[model samples]
Target: MKQPLLTTDFLDRAVDLFADDVGIVAEDGTEYTYGEVGDRVNRLSNALRERGVEKGDRVALLSKNSHYFIETLYATTQLGALFVPLNFRLQPEEYDYLVGDSDPDVFITDAEHAGTVTHLQDEGGVDEWICYDADDAEAGQWDDYEAVLEAASPDQPERPDISEDDDATILYTSGTTGDPKGVVHTHRTQHYHAMVHAHHVEFEDDDVLLWTSPMFHINGWGHIYGLTGIGGKHVIVRDFDPQTVFERIVEHDVSFLGGAPTVLNFLLEHNEEHDVETTGANPVRVETAASPPPKRTIRRTEDELGWRIIHAYGATETGPLITTSNSPRRIQDGDKYDIVNKPGFATINTEVRVVDEDGNDVPCDDETKGEVIARGNQILDRYWNKPEATEEAFTDRVEGWFHTGDIATMDANKMLTIVDRKKDVIISGGENISSIEVQDVLYDHPDVRLAAVIGVPHEKWGETPKALVVPHDGADLTEEEIIEFTRDRLAHYKCPTSVEFREDLPQTSTGKIQKFELREDYWNDDEDRRVN
Candidate 1:
């Protein structure tokens, strides 16, 4: 006999199993127990029903990582409604486009962001706004979430019987060309992904999982459901700061945390100059994705901070945890230089390949690079309302595999390494410059906190690499210095001809630099703008 598959239904079951146990520690020090969490989710679901949110209705949320954010998601799931989470970092104009595209039945937002929601509402056609705190709010004409829940029912209906192939989420992903497309996933895909994470990263029932990453990001790598299914603790944080993260890890004795290279770099850089230590007997584990980690920082994280960092690679369409580097030998014996830069192996049940433009599988001889494609139980079902886009993503024509458009290579041992995003390569003076390579060199500079590289227009070279940098706090910087820093490390053509300083760089909710946004300013004037 086989065991039953875990599903979203198991999320509420965890509340019952862990009832009275602490569920979340808010940024402001507020604690919500499992019982309270269950109650809130129940009330939110009831309130959503009161607004006539039927099964399959799109209910969107735009907010920071908070207890309420988690509640809204589970609440939406309980009713079989699609949970469409907007990136809180998106500007109002971008939000307008997403709102229009998703066409959500109800838009929930925190009071601080009420103004933007209202502005969006005024532009016409949204059904309603549910504000987190509307008691003394300035954004008029919106339902106060707390007020509505006070009178709302807390008796949750039986969990809907959603099919394994039924749509569960629709994540919008940015493209190199045109507007972002919504990548849709199903309950079966997500549940399978959760199991893969458990196998790859060893998520035990006793683990206390931290939400340093956004809940909107592949549902926190399915840990929201995966951890709950195993009766693990959930720790919530609204934002990431080195001191805040360190304190929480110690305070809650957190066993696991996940983020992108940006967050890991911040923690490592901050810890190097400050004294930080874990109070727990075991060192905590940090999971990184989005971009591969830099070799130097990976070493610093392990040697100086005494924390272990592992890499997992996937896109929003695939539920974000398909492949992970988690074997004990990989952790113990693998070179930091190699492991940090590689995308690792496919998780159990995930099949990955490096294929040429013709869709033929490239030889795994370490030297041959090709487009990285994957097919697995975790792959998304479709793109919501966009059949053409869905068809293109699922079938790359060559091998019937879902093409990721990312260039990569694999060793004989099957440790996968990323070459570059097929679309982000900088072709200048007939030479291909990997933007990641240039950016990695820039990050090696002691004064650079964050860096992104994109192609800018150039008459002589056709296109030249441009660098956008955020210097370490209180560090003085100049364009000449940035160019000089990369000059010795990278080829002359790959070195940035121009540099721009920002107090902070723009990032997606997943902590990926919004290179598309950075590329926009450079191409605004040209009608036929092509970065390469």
Candidate 2:
């Protein structure tokens, strides 16, 4: 008599109970009711089925924030196919490995990024190519998305009988030292995570969500499922301009939006400059994650904008919403900013622990910094096609628990305050830039002999990657040249903001570089730890 937990259940309930309600607002301000959204999903699913997408097949999407992201997610998962959403900011070359690794049969993208993967489609990795606004697309032989949907039958697709444990999505996360690894989540994992996250944020049917966060980022922090299931409205924002965000919040009466601390900083700047209205008919609450914001940022966002801030912590491997600072009872006990500033205890039915190098629990005096570990239904099932990497992740510090590689301190109340990154991954502006990845790129420079990358404090972004290099003898490598080299090869955001010339990099006798020592100059002191 038990019902299976499925990701499609969210959309199914929306169409069944809230068909007449507006479910999504497109990037261009067009509204789509749940009925229309369901019709489009059915058409897309049928079209993909006709074109050879089947159970266990992968359907990849490359786009920014849009209604089509939600459509594609349900369409693919409903048919027992795996949904793969790529980071749209990635370069053409950067996608080569992701495409090769995922090996999707169908690839979809927006007109802006259609041409980026033209060569990938031609190489036979993908069987079908569909692009939104195909008339303006630069890629050849791509079919229009609307045309494909119109040609297919607008009926419920014949779904293959699937189980909860079946793989549902593949999200790629940056590996500190090598190629990006795919984090795979099953239907039950996403479904349960959405439910737990919905309760933590206290989502209601009448709530309105502004899609400020990119939909590709952990499925917009899993709001695409939680908000939709609760019969809330989604207002899309394709390009996150500060002015546009404030306007949308005022116009749509947006009750909730996910903005990292860096994004909140931008909004604070714009609000101060223009003196714009921050909210509409509804009180606004923003969910911030990625890297923890500085105390100054939290104070300004609350004092100036007058919006409630819910800070969270987790990686793409975790549910990305496993921990949140949104305790109503605790707010009455202490100052509001002090309570919401740190990532509070784990969500309902989730277990989080801070463990020492020996896998023992650290004293929760808010002083002992240890690696964060978690276990929950929301965690990723496995890393796609990388069994060794998956095993290492779960067994590195504690056996059977997912080692998060994030260094944090827990309070007496089990609240977690992140201090640094153990793996050297730089979380700048809500995007994970692998310090090793940048170092690898720097090593390719002919003038560079020894290279290291570390996150340094930034006024705008939470922090940014900075490169330190020891040039070869008599090789005059300027800072501009080092920065320009990475810009040409990597995404501009992933490039180093500044470079430093050094005579030698501190290394152990075993030739391993000590980045923590190099980070001391950029970071203030022991009290001011690196908030990766």
Stretches > 4 Å off in candidate 1: 1-6, 120-126, 278-281, 331-333, 397-399, 473-503, 524-532
TM-score of every prediction relative to native: 0.91, 0.82
| TM-score of candidate 2 against the unseen true structure | 0.82
Candidate 1 lDDT at 115 equals: 71
lDDT of each: 0.79, 0.86
Clashes of each: 0, 0
Q: Residues 328-351, candidate 2, lDDT per residue (tens digit)?
A: 898898877777879889999999
